[model samples]
Target chain A: MSRTLFFTSLLYRSTTEHKRAIAEFCSNVKMCRLTEQVVFSDPYKISQYNRWTAPYLDEDAEAVRQDNDLKLEIAELKAKFCERAQALLHGDLHTSSVMVTRDSTRVIDPEFAFYGPMGFDIGAFLANLILAFFAQNGHSNGEDDRKAFKRYICQTIEETWSLFEQKFIALWNEHRDGSGEAYLPGIYNNPKVLQLAQKKYMADLFHDSLGFGAAKMIRRIVGVAHVEDFESISDPGKRAACERKALDFAKLLLKNRRSFVQIGGVVRAMRQVEE
Target chain B: MSRTLFFTSLLYRSTTEHKRAIAEFCSNVKMCRLTEQVVFSDPYKISQYNRWTAPYLDEDAEAVRQDNDLKLEIAELKAKFCERAQALLHGDLHTSSVMVTRDSTRVIDPEFAFYGPMGFDIGAFLANLILAFFAQNGHSNGEDDRKAFKRYICQTIEETWSLFEQKFIALWNEHRDGSGEAYLPGIYNNPKVLQLAQKKYMADLFHDSLGFGAAKMIRRIVGVAHVEDFESISDPGKRAACERKALDFAKLLLKNRRSFVQIGGVVRAMRQVEE
Candidate 1:
C-alpha cells in the first residue's frame, strides 16, 4: 500500500544500512500462544470467551460448533497459520493500523508483527471495512444515515484489490530482472510465461487474504475480541444482528475463498449478503 | 516411522505428560545455508561443484540450466522446502539414512533433522529407489542381472505407499476419538465425513511426497552430489544415459506430480522410463 511505502520510506532513511535487512525476528510467543487459541482453535469449538446475542444466535453458534466440513477446512487453515512462514507480515493490520489524512498516511501498532502470509494484513483491512459496511444499518440516524458510508466502505474494498493487482503486476514487470528469489529473471524472462506465473501467485495471495480476513472477522464477532463496528451499536439485539451477518460472511469467505477470482466478485457477494 | 515410535516410546516412558511441544525450531540454518546452494541455487545458476558425465551429458545439463519452466518449478519447490513446516521431517532422508539388518530395521543419520513436510522423507526414499531402478541398467553382470531386483525395488515403492495409506487410515479410524488437534473427534466423529477428510489429506500428502521426491532425484543427478547409482558405472557414456533418464523422469514427475492419483501410476511410469 502507498501508506506502507510512506512509512517504510521514513524507516528506510533512518536505518544505517540500506541493505534489505532481512532478519527472522523471534515472534512474541505469548501472543502466538494467545492468538492460536482465539483465531484458530476456540471459535470452532465451544469456549467461555465466545459470545453472541443469547437466544438469538444460540442455535447459530451451535451450528458452527457442529459443522464438520467447516471444522475440517479450519483445521487446514489453522495448520497453515501456525506452520507456514511465507513472509514477514503485519500480523495486526486492521483498519486501526492505518491512518489517512489530506496529505499524510501512517501505519501504527505493529507490535504483533511477525513472519506470516501477506494476505493476513490485506485480509484484516478488507474484513474490517466489510464489518463497517454491515454495521452501517445499526449506525443509521435521522440526519447522517450510514447508507452512503456503507457504499464508501465497499468502494474502498474494491479499489484496494484492483489497484493492488495492477500495481503489483507493474512492479513485478519493473523488477523482472532483479534478484527476487521467488521468480528468477533468467528463468522467467519471457513475457508470456512470467504473466502466467504472476497470475497464479496473485490468485494464491488473494485466497490467503480472504481466508485470513474471514478468520479475523470471525474472531471479532465470537472469539475473545469484538470489533468497534459491532461493539458501538447500543442495542444488544441490533449489535448481534450486525455481528451475525459479518460472521456468516466470514465463514463463507473462509470456506469458499478459491471460488473467487476477482475482487469485484467478492464485493458483489458482500452486497448480496442478507442483512 | 517404526524408528520414530521406538524413539517416542523411549521418550514416552521417560515422562507421563507428553506435551504438544510446538516450537518453530530455528531451522538448522547452517544446513539450509548449505543446501540452498547444492539443492536449489547452485544447480539452477552456476557453480563449480556441479558436474555430470561431462562431455557426454554436457548438453543435457546445459538444457536443464537453460530451461525456464524447469527453473520456475524448481523455485516454487525450493521455497516450499525452505518455508513450509508441515511436520517434523527427516531433513536428509536419502537411501543413505535408512538401514536394514536381518531382524532389525532402523533409520540413521538424522543429524539434519528438523520440522518439515512428511513428504520430504517419503519422497527421498521413493526417489532413491527409482534411482536404484535406473542404475540397474548399469549394475548388470553375469550374476543375478537385477531383473528380479528391479521388480523388488518397484514392489517396495508400491508397498511403501499402499501400506502407509492402509495403516494411516486404520490408525485414524481407531484414534478418531483421540486428542489429535488436526481433526477433532467432536466434529469429524462420523464415518462418512471422516473418510472424506482422510481421502483429501492422503491425496495432498501423496502430491507433496512426489514433488519433494522429484526435487531430491533431480538434485542427486544434476547438482553437486552424484548418486552411486550413476557413479558406480565405469563407462561415462553409459553413466550419462542412466543419469539423463533419471533427470528426465524427475522433471516429468515434478511438473506433473498432481496428475498421478496413485503410486502404481508412478511405478508404471518408472517401468516405462527405459535404460
Candidate 2:
C-alpha cells in the first residue's frame, strides 16, 4: 500500500525472496552458489571445480578431505552456514565489495545479501584482510614498500574488531533496559551479570567470526574462486608459496578459533605465520 | 508448476511464510507462547509469568537468575532456538503431544513444526519423561506403589535415546554413498572416517539434546506453563519437593551435558538427584 524511494551511489538490491532463494538455490545458482560450493561443500571433498596451485597444493587439498578433525571442524561451520539465521549478510565481501579512498568508503554490489550469521559479515571482512596480508609476499618485487601496507592492514584488522567490540558493548549497555530480550533488564540488570553476559556474547561471536573468516580464506586458495591478490602473482610457482601460507594460517584459524580470546592474539599469530 | 495431493496423519505445509512466522511469533503466540517464555525467555528474567512453589522454590528461582554460568548456558540455547534450523522439529512434544494405544501410537498436531534444532525435539520428548519422573512422588498416595510406573518412564527415556542413536547411525551408514554434502562419499566414505564422523555427530547431538531437555524441564518448573504431570499432584508441599528435584537435575543437565557421553550417565544422574 505504500511506496518508498531511495537515492544512493550503490544498489544493494535486497530481495525479500532472499531466504527462500538461499534454501532453493543453495546447491546451485550464482554467488550464493559460490558460498554453497566453495565454503560449505567443495573444500571438504574432491570436486572438479576445486583447484589449487595444482602440483603444490595437491597434498594440502587431499589432506583437508582426509583429516577427520579438520573435516569435523569444517562440518560444524558448514552446519552453521545452512542452519543459523543470525543476520542479513553480504555473503561474499572479499576485497571486491568495498570501494575505499583516503576520505570515504562505500560498500557495493551486495547481490548475495541474505539473512545469515552476523559473524559471516564480520568474518568476510576480516578474512579478506588476512588474505591481503598473506598475499603481500606475492606482490613483492624485492622491495619493503608494502611493509607499511601490511602493517596498516594488520592495524585495520585489530582496530576494526576493537571498535566493533566497544560499539557492540556500548549499544548493549544503552539498550540493556530497552525491549531487547537477549539480556532482559529485570534479570541481568545487575552490573556483574550484565558484564558476564556481554563477555560470553562477544566471545562466541569472536570465535564464529574467526571460523567463518578462515573458511573464506581457505576457499579462495583451494576451492573454485581465486582472489586477484594471489591470482595476479603471474608465476604459479611463486603464487603457490603465498597461498600455501594463507591456507595453513586459515586452517589454524578455523580449527583453533575457540582458543583465541582477543583480536590481538589473532593478529600476533598472523604476524608469526607471515614471518 | 505441479499439483500435489495429501491425506495423512501429518501435514507438511510448505509455506513461503514459514520463516517469518517462526521468527515473529516465536515467543508470542498460542501454546507456543509457553516455549517463547519457559524455554527461551522468562527463565532468564524475573517475569510475572514465572512462578515456582512459593515457599519452597523461591531461593532456587532466585539462584537461577543469579547464576551467571547457568544464565549463559540458557542464553546459548536461546540463540540456538532463535538461530539454528538443524531439522524439521516437532516443537511442542510434551506428554500432551503423544497419544498411545496398546500396539499403535500416533503423533498428532505438529502445529509448532518448523526448521529447528533436532535437539529441541529430542529434548522436549526426554524432558517430558524427566518431568513425569519428578511428578511420581507428588502422585504417590498411601495405598498402592507407583514405583513400577516411575521405572517405566525412566526405562522409556533410556530406551528412546539409545534406539534413536542406533537408528540414526544406521541411516547415516546406509546413506553414506548418497547425495549428502556433510560427509562426501569420496572423502568420508572410508570406514574409519565415517565412523568418526558419526561418533562426533551423535556426541554433539546428545549434548544439544540434554541442554534442550534441561531447558524444557526448567521452564516447566519456573516459567509460564506447568505440566499435568506436576499439576495432578494435589498437595503443594509434595509437588514442590518433586519439582525442586527436577529443577536441580535440569540445572545440572544444562550446565554439564558435555561431561555425559552416554545416556546411562544421565539416568544415573537423575536417580542420584532423586536420592
Candidate 3:
C-alpha cells in the first residue's frame, strides 16, 4: 500500500536545491496546521465535531480526553508532525484514498499532501489496515467467520512495514555516495558507521510510525470523521466492541511505542487485545 | 542579547494563519541549508575552506574529523537544524549582529533570519560569549588579568539562559488562553498539565540551545570561519590553547547535552575543561 507513496517520495533527489524547492512548495499548503488540528488535537479535546458510539463508548471517549499521559504523548507527536519536514507525505493516506485493482494500485486525493514525516503516510495506511483487521469480527457471520481474513490483514500490515524498510535501506545504499544532505557520504561512508546510521534511522522511523498510526486510529474512532470498516457493521454493539479493542491497542501504542522495536511485535499485540 | 529576537518571535501570535505566513516567509530564505553546510557539515569533513592554527593544533583538528561518535551526534543536530521549524530565528545571531548603547540596543544583520528552532539564535549568542570567556586568558596581562572579567562572563551566560526561560514561560502563561496553535488552552488548561507542558517545552529548548551552542563554538574553531575571540591573540600557542579548551567543552556538550538539566550545570561544565 505504501509502495507508491514511498516511490513518489524517492522521485526527488535530496540535493540542496531539490530540498529547498520541495520545502518551499510544501510551505504554501498549510497541511501541517490542518493535520495538527484534526489528527492530533481535536480528537483529544471536547470538540463538538467529535462523535462515537455515544452511549456505548461515552466513557471510553472521555477516558481518551482525561488520559493525561496520552494527551502528553499526542502533544509530542503533534509537534513532530508540525516541525519535521522529513519528506513529501500523502497527508491523508487512508484506505479510501487508495484504489487497488489486483494488478495495480493508485493513491489519490492529495489535497492534504505536503512535506511531513514519512511515517505519517506509512502509519495512515497501516492504521486503516488495522482498523479493518479489528472490524472483521463485526462483519463475521456464522459460516464465514473472518478469522482467516483478520490474519491476512495482520500479514499485510507486517509486510507493508518490512518491505518499506527493506526498499528504503536499499535506496539509501544506492545513493549513499550522492549529494544527499541528511547523511553525507564522506562521514557515513564507513560500512560499519553506515550500518549504525541506518539502524538508528529505521528504529526512529519505526517508533514514529507506531505513534502516528496509533494517533490516526484514535482520531478516527472518536474524532469528527470515521472509517467504513466499523461503520459498515449494522450492529452498533458489535461495532463498538471492535472499536474499543482498536482504541485500547492504540492507547497502548501511543504511550509505549518506543518499547516496540519491530512490526511483528505490534501485530502480536494487536491480536492479543480483547474484542 | 536575545531580548530582541525573543520579542520579535512573540510579536506574532501563533494563530494558524500567522504561523503559515511566517513559515512561508522563512521557507524562501534558504538559511537552513547554509547553516547546515557551514556549522554542522563542513568542519567535520575535509574541506579546502576549513583551517585552524595549522601545525599548532593540527592533531586536534584531525581528532575532530576522526571522532565517529561526534560525527554521529553532529548528523543528528544537523538533521534537527534542517528539519525542525519551531520559531522565527535571527539565523545568524552571533555577537557582531548586535549593536548596544547606554540607552538602547539594536540587532542588525538579519540576512539569515528564518523560521527555525529558537535555540539556534539563543545558542549562537551564548556560544560566542563562551568563546570570549575562553579567549580571556590569551588577552590577560599582569596589570589587568581577566579573571574577574571571566567570572563576569560566566554570570552573564547563566543569566542569559535563565532570563530567557523565565521570560518565554511568562509569555506562554500570559497567553495561555490565546489562539496559539502549539498548546491549546482547552487541553492544557489545568495547572498541573500546564506546568508539565511548560517544563517539557523549556527542557527541550534548553537542550537544543546547548547542542546548537556547542556546534556554533566548534565551527568557530575548526570550520572555515574563525572567531575574533581566538583570532586576535598575537601568540599562536596562546590562541591554540584557548581554542582547544573551547573545542573540548563544545564536544562534551554536543555529545551529552541531555544529561544536563540546568543552565548552572552547563556553566560549571564549561569552566571545568582544562585550558
lDDT string for model 3 (A128-218, tens) is 9999998888888855578788878999999999999998888777767765677887667578877887788889889999999999999
Chain B TM-score of candidate 2 stands at 0.86
TM accuracy, model 1? 0.84
Off by over 4 Å in 1: A1-27, A141-147, A165-180, A184-186, A189-194, A234-241, B2-27, B54-59, B140-145, B165-181, B184-195
Query: Which regions of candidate 2 deviate over 4 angstroms?
Result: A1-31, A143-145, B1-34, B141-146
Clash list (residue pairs), candidate 3: none
Sort every candidate by lDDT, greatest first. Answer: 3, 2, 1
lDDT of 2 at A228: 86
Error of 2 at A256 (Å): 1.4
Error of 3 at A248 (Å): 1.6
- What lDDT does candidate 3 reach at residue B212? 93
True contacts kept of each: 0.28, 0.39, 0.41
Q: DockQ of candidate 3?
A: 0.46
lDDT of 2 by residue, B43-76 (tens): 7677887887888888988888778888778878
Residues B5-96 of candidate 1 have per-residue lDDT tens digits of: 22322112211111122133443556654665677666666668887788987788778777767776776676566555555566777888
CA RMSD for every model? 5.0, 6.1, 2.7
Q: Which prediction has more favorable TM-score, 2 or 3? A: 3
**Whole-model Cα lDDT per candidate?**
0.71, 0.74, 0.80
Candidate 1, residue A162: lDDT: 83
Candidate with the larger lDDT of 2 and 3: 3
